[model samples]
Target chain A: MTLKKKQLIECQSLWKIFGQKAKTAMQAVKERNLTKEQVHNEFDCIVGVQNATFSVDEGEIFCIMGLSGSGKSTLIRHINRLIEPTSGEIFIDGENINNLNQTELREIRSSKIGMVFQNMALLPHKNVRENVAFALELRGIDKKSRDKVANETLETVELSGWGDRYPDELSGGMQQRVGLARAIAANPQILLMDEPFSALDPLIRRQLQDQFIELSQIMHKTTIFITHDLDEAIRIGQRIAIMKDGMLVQIGEPEDIVTDPVDDYVAKFVSGISNLHLVTAGKIMQSIAEYEASAGPVKEESLLKAKLDDDLDCLIDLSIKTDEPILIESESKIVGIVSKKTLLAGIQGHWNT
Target chain B: MADEVKFSILDPFSAIDIGIADWADGIKEWATNNREAIQPVKNYLNDVIIWMNDVLQALPPLITIACIAIISLQFAGKKVTGIVVICLVAIGFLDPRAWDLTMTTLSIVVTSVLISAIIGLPLGILAGKSDRFEQLIRPILDTMQTIPAFVYLVPVVMLVGIGNVSGVLVTIVFALPPLVRLTSLGIRQVNPSIVEAAKAFGASPSQILCKVELPLSAPSIMAGLNQTIMLALSMVVIASMIAVKGLGNEVLRAMGRLDAGKAIVGGAGIVLLAIVLDRITESFGLSKREKGVRHWWESGPIGLFYNQYKKLN
Candidate 1:
């Protein structure tokens, strides 16, 4: 209801230039405002991330979506300083990570952040338990304790009893679960997943996404999830950040991003995504007081009721039964109304606040 | 009758020398001049070789044969072990000296492999970690492997003089490259994603190397070690040119005297040794490559102790 959650991660104008003499090229870009293509042409330096600025709230899944070279992967790496930014500062809970020394940086990486990569990245030599316990092993945890933690995390990922098998012994989906288990075994406060499910078959990917959502709820690990798939971001993220050519195009709630993209690039990206299931009654409905005054009168008994959180698809199902407008209520109090017109507009991505 | 062209270009090929002979001569002179400075290394190697050779020679032939059979059984299985024992018995019956020669050859091969592993592993690991190191050493390793084995003997004879030490030294130089190459290759070929994942989890450089890179690269390293062992055995005969006696020396002598029967016997001994070592180490590498499963025989006799050890581990 209120925007009170503390920002767990903040990136301020982060830029990553990759090539020889990147520092000089970055300086020129900052002073003269050179375009990304121009920088590439002039200095032959590739800009991996450009002027990327955003924050992720505690316990929220912030999805960064883009085409392959859009720098979403590079951007997420900066949160833990895996890729050093040419310019800008990243703060995790207000601690400027870029300024931290190697030891401190390592400490933060080992203890504060857990990362899952697209390739699964399970050590081929390590069995499931060992791969999952790798972070703990790095921390110098005793074998027994780390194994105990690893086994428990394995169970959480639905990989119980497979701890003795090598990574190659498992199916692709199972191995990815081991990857997920490896990340969460350390119980780091933040999880950075860079297209962790992107490599799987669609059905397996969806199953993993569902499992991930359930796990995130139980673990409450603040996550910055990166993916190229818009549907994945929309399905899993609380807030989505869309990037193009190493720049953040828009960062907003999924419904807002889908229905009211700020520009054509964002709009085109969301164009293929159906808003029927995404847009909610709370987003499309008129205020209850205004609707009551304009439309006849509120009937106490006979009117069909729906929740503010009900999606357009659910409202459509509700609306098919009667001609009466659906009353959107929150906590047993009427908050707004989603009529047939509003439901259709919401489904078509034309609904706006 | 021929009109020679003045300042003929092809004439320089005959007159001018660009071979390594001068370098070898210069190194020999330098070592002789700095004999006091180099004596300690030579002395150390000599002592180590003497001790190793004595240990190998002290063991009764039957005991050594039985030990190899047991080890072969554990690794390569009963079939390979059966072949190994048959070879040993046949060698013993054919010529007692040949049997002893095979043992001496084994001693040299084992010691050289151990030394090569000690030197090659860290070098390989260093090369693996740094691309520049790999680039720098790549040409050198190529040169080492390509040069005739006899060329290695020249430097070894100069530095360490004649004995098992020189033999062992030459074998090391000949065999060392594979271990180094394979170790680096193995480490380099390790899945980059796995290393990145390890790094993302805050694994230190050493930790990533030891825990992730090395373990993943082990099959390659083992393959490299196998190559090193085979190459070392191959060089044993050439190594005997410098008076390092073994199956190689027997073969060399039998060839010199034109004794076909003796050469055949000596060559057979070497071949048998090669097969035994090859099968054992190859099987060991195969086991490591399996990742998770271990064959029942690899657990050793009774399997109870191995099961307990695995559990504890």
Candidate 2:
């Protein structure tokens, strides 16, 4: 945990109070340590983001998950200064974003970061080609080259040969792809996606999630993906930050958030999510030395061998076929062992690795 | 001149005198006194009207009709183009001089509509962007639309005097409100998320206005333009009272003598003119809707042509 990665975006104690007296309200809250509800009652102000702090590492998908009014979306907007914070500072690659002037902020938005929204904000008047090429065009990229780049980016999103059609001509799923294509067309260093696929049907949402996961690996762009859907967060996010009432409840890996949520709200949010697909063997496995000392695991060949990162579902499937405990391996070296009892405990969120 | 004595037109709702002949007379007197101050504006307005008239007169009737037919066919399609051709051809054959009359009315309408758009669109964009501006203009547009057309003409006649210049000025005043209102409406109706998207992508205010807001709101703005043109055409007959010659003059003269056939013919010409302008402008406005449908004719002739051209390219 102490081994720090290169932080691309670090937001410190960010607060955004949305009201006529937002600045005063924010000052009062900081001075008195007033709760969000207390500030609302005292100042008639609604807090959109409150004391939210998290860092997204380079090439990591940092997800913010919460319901409609959870401020997850509001928090991500601060990174690009779309919603300017009333107090606190945001640093993108160690440069404080809040201190930057309008021109610098715009430069960051146009060149450094790309954002996709829940509404799939493709211009209706623009054809798919023009829509995808818009960012490049804004940067004064030549039409011939930008169109080629747009076509290539569209193909990357599996939307080739659909460039000539307007957004209204495409299906909702196709439109979302075009949106993603547009964001990536400029080849920005970071991406901010605000529930980009929440409006889609579950089947399509899942498909896009899978594609995004693959795309993230190839593009390696630091992404702040906001969603209310826990399943989507678990599927794509390398780390998840859960927000409630404009405050960060917990920020952890999907396993940590699901298995060891810091509060009742987060626990409740993750209650319906099955750890079978989320929880990994490494998270619930007994230490290799401890297992060998107690159970005499001296054998080189094992019938049931599972990767440390293998989900509980795969471990369960393996355990059902045989009475032997599953051997957990990491980087081709046996790291730990997961017994059936541990699997049950892991399912019940009681096991601690 | 003898008909000027009949000034007591009564309202069904009330017996109050709606006539404002005295106000017109007073304004005229005031205008004459301030003639030097307004001379430059009056001269500029007259020059614009004269130029417009000369342009319309310069083109051959057949050529003008052919151009209108092609332009109409391109946008509104075969149905609208067919209607325009039939109506204009009927006018040409029925009365030889009617071609010149049609051209004159067209020149006035086109000039006024262009001027209305020039003034109205920027006002509409301002109103669309600012709540205060919208509130301020809303009442003014209401007054402009609701005021009796003939009543406003009195002030117009006083300022610009009579002839095609006065006709153009009056038409511009009458036709302006719709374009302004609709442009505001169009910009207001733009999806907030799309505007945010533009902002997120680092578009400047002007870029957002031009690239996102204006283009997205174009349908509504064009709709406003259509209404303005229709209103301008309607003003022609009224404009004829100030010696602005056109089909309106024919209609006014025919109506004065109670000549039914001539009145009907003049009215028909105006209707045909309206259909031509309405359809062409409407096609531009409905282009977005046309994009949604894959059918060739669903987008009208202009859309079909554009779609095919895109495929070929």
DockQ of each: 0.71, 0.57
Off by over 4 Å in 1: A1-3, A281-310, A324-342, A351-353, B1-24, B289-298, B308-313
Model 2, A112: alpha-carbon shift in Å? 0.8
Error of 1 at A266 (Å): 1.6
> Candidate 1 chain A: worst 10 consecutive residues by lDDT?
A344-353
Across B219-242, the per-residue lDDT of candidate 2 in tens digits comes to: 899899999999999999988999
Best by lDDT: 1
- How good is the docking of model 1, by CAPRI class? medium
Per-candidate iRMS values, in order, are 0.8, 0.8
CAPRI rating of model 2: medium
Please report, in order, the local distance difference test score of every candidate based on alpha carbons: 0.87, 0.86
